[model samples]
Target chain A: MTSSTTEPIKITSKEQAEWFLNQYDTFLFDCDGVLWLGTHLLPRTKEILNYLTELGKKLIFVTNNSTKSRLTYTKKFASFGINVTEDQIFTSGYASAVYVRDFLKLQPGKDKIWIFGEAGIGEELATMGFESLGGIDTRLDEPFDATTSPFLQNGLDDDVKCVIAGLDTKVNYHRLAITLQYLRKTESVHFVGTNVDSTFPQKGMILPGAGSMVESIATSSGRRPSYCGKPNANMLNTIISAKNLERSKCCMVGDRLNTDMKFGVEGKLGGTLLVLSGIETEERALEINEAYPRPKYYIDTLGDIFDLTH
Target chain B: MTSSTTEPIKITSKEQAEWFLNQYDTFLFDCDGVLWLGTHLLPRTKEILNYLTELGKKLIFVTNNSTKSRLTYTKKFASFGINVTEDQIFTSGYASAVYVRDFLKLQPGKDKIWIFGEAGIGEELATMGFESLGGIDTRLDEPFDATTSPFLQNGLDDDVKCVIAGLDTKVNYHRLAITLQYLRKTESVHFVGTNVDSTFPQKGMILPGAGSMVESIATSSGRRPSYCGKPNANMLNTIISAKNLERSKCCMVGDRLNTDMKFGVEGKLGGTLLVLSGIETEERALEINEAYPRPKYYIDTLGDIFDLTH
Candidate 1:
């Protein structure tokens, strides 16, 4: 655990590829880094996904991205010339809706959730016919007298039973203020964050992610959310129960160890693979093992593995 | 200390008030509760200040509110018929400017400070001819696409040597984004907060304060500001150097324990007074001592001691 893959067998030839390809029936892949960087899809990514599909492997795209819905993800994959179904895509946003609906049993009319994210979260929550408040165009951005002793004219609703925070660009102070107010009213309001990625990738730039935005409310409220994304094992429950896949026959493929690899190891999946197409590097991955458990396999990029499939 | 002050001297009798009033010549007062509760000036507040003035005691009003400048504060006192001069007032905003200009040595001509509060913080910094970018009227509140991967089209100014965050009502995501971009640059850029109050007093409701706003920036940048208000010794240095008084001859009087009482103890002032006119009560004060050092003196209210003088 304190070092990177200790002499990991690199899949160089078709014989070596057949070893792992035959062993696992289910493959969970982290998008963004392993498949594409920003909008530019990586070379051989579509081909590898097709190759995996040809073998009748159950493929699921596990993304930490809470800004886009599963339908948007499906359209995005289609634009990339790879037809991805909604069932095969498991975004953190969709999982968050699942957490609120089925897991917590928040019925359509009885309960409401206060969202602190963008359209992705709103779209997913809408799918379950759940009502939400405090996203964009909610007009929480109206300027008030920047006074210390503010007058109370606003009324509170008793129906809000959950406060969910995700990657929000329009996250203003009022969203945080209202979220804290809901949590302070009662202990029953469950707090859930989509994911806690410290920083997220954009086009040639990295910005502060959901974890950075969520810390204020967490600190102010003196309560931490039950995170429903990667680094938490609950995200895989949907796939595990749906496929009835054995732990020994599942493998996780991701570019980072903390979220992707950690998810697999913590969830008790069969194996883990680390690719160096995104944030982590070959040298940095060795140092990272000191903190998180080492991944089972390491490769330079997804492009490096397609040669073994031949 | 791990315990509260056991058997704190309660200033009930005239003899008790005469003791500390005769011993300490330097008196520091916290504004919110000791003098007035919200907009209502407490009974006998003006009489006590006038009485202290007749006794030749040097007095200064220290406030953690950053929404107003020292000039505005002097005007506020005048409106209350107190006739207090500008020199008798020191706000957290004024202290923040002093921190950057005098303490951190951020030169006006060469270096600039980025502000994330209101006009109050900007006015104080401007008094010293220090230019700061960002704050109210910055137009960061304007709507943009709440996208996950926002492209970086804006360039950063390298002249900003210090970033000061206060209780901003207009705080948006861009302010947090720009501040992090500045801090992420060089280690030379300093981060400063007016005060770290988690929540502050409003009319009927308590809202998220400066501490809540500053946290995301502090957490994201991984750099803490040189805080310039209560519980910090720097506020005392302003009074100590100006009045040429020893710490042992000074006393701090306020309604709150954490900010006011801790300010006195941490600054090594001669005495500390806690008034139950505001947040704390007899029962709560006793329990608070378990975590923080108890104040040396306790009274029902400052109005109680004014009766002793009468």
Candidate 2:
């Protein structure tokens, strides 16, 4: 309903936790902040997920990190001793791959995808049977030479039908130069961004996220990319339709307000929950503002649900 | 003057050229597109500059290229057989250095300027007697290791007072990660951008400009950088004050309507001239719109002045 005026209900008691559990049949969780922090899983997070699964609630882990594919995320979950399958993980890389195929309806063999990102996007697209180029190419790491660079001399691959920009750690002038050429080429290929998260928490520090790469590409190409991540509604709808889940019966939980909370509220999910283990704090999130909607429920951490119930 | 409603005058006749020469005592010329196209000089450009110099009118080369310092630009001018001094060249690199030292009032030895750019910005800052770091550092080119990176372990330099972002061909994750660290440090650092030109013409192709780097840093740091290039009154005012010239007596001649023409119009310069030798075409420039001001005058090429007068 009206989220701006409504004060967020803090999940502190057992009755409140019981009400939350009974209200939603499905739960969407943000990975970086909600599920874990860096390499360490937040306390009681695994037990909470297990309890929710035992209660017959559907669980989906949504992450904006485009550097890792679904398989990589599944591996990360396995490492953390959390049983999450690849199908249950919705990374921006997987979402972009799905968008390129299903929404854009690109023919796999006929249409080629150009990547201005890391190996994650390429891996995801490859799994969907799409032939992609430019990701994790060591040649792009070399210093750009106008006279000698292969892209500059030999020209661009003409069959590239789409360009996907994501978090690229090895981003250099050579990579951006070739991407710009494809973006400005005749017959204007589709431009897509895996996500637009400005920064993500890395250990104890904040670092540039995939949004930085997307903005860089957008600036050079003078073209805005179609985003396929959280807060865009595209990714949420895709997940909903693929799993045949009702939006009214689903609850979204995340640590960030702009991406995760907005993703839930705008998508008209049943409820939105905020966890204080990631980028946002309880003080900042509770500050009533028009910029971002306050979450319906707030908890000290994602593990608070387990703590309250058990 | 209501430039949106007014049509740009095409200087085709000798009488019109004489009128233009009489109207302005000082001319601000954009280097890349106005004077030379890449390393090659346009036809009669040398002759035009010679004639203009002989006429006793002051000429200032205002360029948004931050990759090269004023000394480098002067050398470029010399290589082209054009007699020009370092003071005559006002590059974005030089302008940014001045902004940090003069406007920001950063004292030498006490305040350090961190550069997220090429050698040009460091060169300019060094010329001003300010100690700088991080520009063109080969160590940043190495693959980022969260565990082994020195910046991740030791933290950032506390003396870094300001961060200057310009066109950096060697930009990598390590560089951005370090810059983001300084920006998010307890003592906030001033963020400055050399220019905001989205793309620059490179030989035959267009590539990512300094603005792309600027936007990337801004997105990650969640801080907007103070731009010191075209369309921003800071650079124009700096030049005007340094030269002790009246704004009404100077005309800005450039190829791009957004930056060059907007700079002139917004700065309240005497007039603005558009040249067709660079990125823009006649058809696009002539299209009357409010987004960009119609130039007071336009020519087929910068050399048209020499042709008209001769």
Candidate 3:
């Protein structure tokens, strides 16, 4: 853990940047606001990535948005004229699949997960040899029959040992009911939410994200799902476990304080860099939850490091 | 308002029961647990009611379950071979309608409310000359077109100034999406939840109640809804406003601590009574939340009052 008693310092000087660069070999970058907003790439981020790559630094893209899989994110990176492989992306969905397979210790082929998300979550779990039930377009088409008590009705997939919730545009009552049924009817089923990011920054505007989806199941069921996203630091740990990286030689770079900064701080990485390119302004950063971990450093943008390169 | 320095006293004697019964001429009872378990009536409850009637005590039935309207509840009483008037019953649906009409101060026929519940909530709102939108049996039959964003398609009701949520068996993504759209997409829209009762006791088993139904909209919308059910004290206040009853002369009697006991306690009624005939067992009563209102007295059951009357 980063046992630093010191507060986050402003990374303004070249010497500070040089010292920071020398400390970490692996860098995790938060996409959306930090890298690009929607289709438009942020200024100097490409140059920064190229500079880091030239130095032979390991780069990983992390996002809480589970709507898109690594494959889709790869295309998203390419759309912005940035080169990022699917392997370099660590999504909440991917983390969730890993969590289910590893942490929960559910057998991939035998123990199934009822998914209240899109193909992104499904794809990741599938890649891990796990079957995902009722995802995206696979909505519950069961007609409401007043004559039948759905709880009393049999034929529900008894194999489902987990319910993983994510942002599903096609979320409906039947899906929620089925999920609740899995949680209620079944014994000892694990409830997982990919991330509870209440909103997502996209194209200069914030939109409702995964937290909304998780809220319903939690409220109705009177049960909170174990979240697998930023602020939890599971994503960084997952990367570390997979790649066997030096924990003390890694840094997390992001725009948001609550998730990204908290993730990095809790991970006890070499450093956490907060960029003001997204949701949290410098003024807003002053008022943070006392419980949350603070970033090690704050900068105006990822491009601010250009001064260091100069 | 029950300014008692004394903790809840056990009603173990006739003198204690006499002091309790004599304190409140107006007794509000929670239906499902206090009176009967679904279709089956509890032992000696009818006799206790008969004795209370002999003493000419004013009995009012209050419930947070918005699934059944006062008219439906009247029939439920009739099914139990009990005498009850529609006026004597106050359901969350009735409370919600009253709240919207009197509390929210929304102009009827001008400001509309989108209903995310059953016919009970709809009928109650209708009684108040208010228009209700979606409800039970009103499924969003629209097929998910992956190519299109549901929010972009026009045809959503725009005049809706409020979204009232309750125990909607027909709760689906479209309903939740519409609720979220109103809360997030619309401007200054009111969000109201009928109640947040997590579970309802039925014959031999407990099932998820309206609270579970409300959980989704609250979670997904990222906005907390104003509730009009038991423990909120609004139901009691609504009754007080309509009937102009003496608040000090009233007491709430039920099986649950969170809802029924809290209702009476917060209402500043004479006292609250807990009976061990329903959801909560005597052992569970020992672990009352310090934040919640406590009952003034406890007994084996509502039927246990027979010993006092005798």
Chain B alone, TM-score of each model? 0.93, 0.96, 0.90
The TM-score between candidate 3 and the true structure equals: 0.78
**Between which residue pairs do clashes occur in model 2?**
none
- The CAPRI category of model 1 is medium
Model 3 score (lDDT) = 0.78
For all the models shown, what interface RMSD does each have?
Answer: 2.6, 0.9, 3.9
User: Which window of 10 residues has the lowest lDDT sum in candidate 2 chain B?
Assistant: B1-10
> After superposing candidate 2, which stretches have Cα over 4 Å from the reference?
A1-5, A186-188, B1-5, B151-153, B186-188
- Calculate DockQ per candidate and list them: 0.50, 0.81, 0.35
TM-score of 1: 0.91
Tens digits of per-residue lDDT, candidate 2, A1-310, equal 4355778988999999999999999999998878888888899989999999999999998988888889998899999998889889898888999999998999888899999998889999988888998879888878887888876677778779899998898888888888888899954699999999888878677878899888998988889999999988889988998899999999999998889998999899999999998888889789877767899999989898898998
Comparing 2 with 3 on TM-score, the higher-scoring candidate is 2
lDDT of 1 by residue, B100-175 (tens): 8778988987788888898889998888898878777545656532243132244667788988998887777777
lDDT of 3 by residue, B87-159 (tens): 9999999999988888889888877888888889988887777877777533453542322435435655677
Candidate 1 wrong stretches, greater than 4 Å: A1-18, A144-154, B2-4, B143-154, B288-290
Using TM-score, give the best candidate's number: 2
TM-score of chain A of each: 0.92, 0.97, 0.91
Q: Highest DockQ among the candidates is held by which one?
A: 2
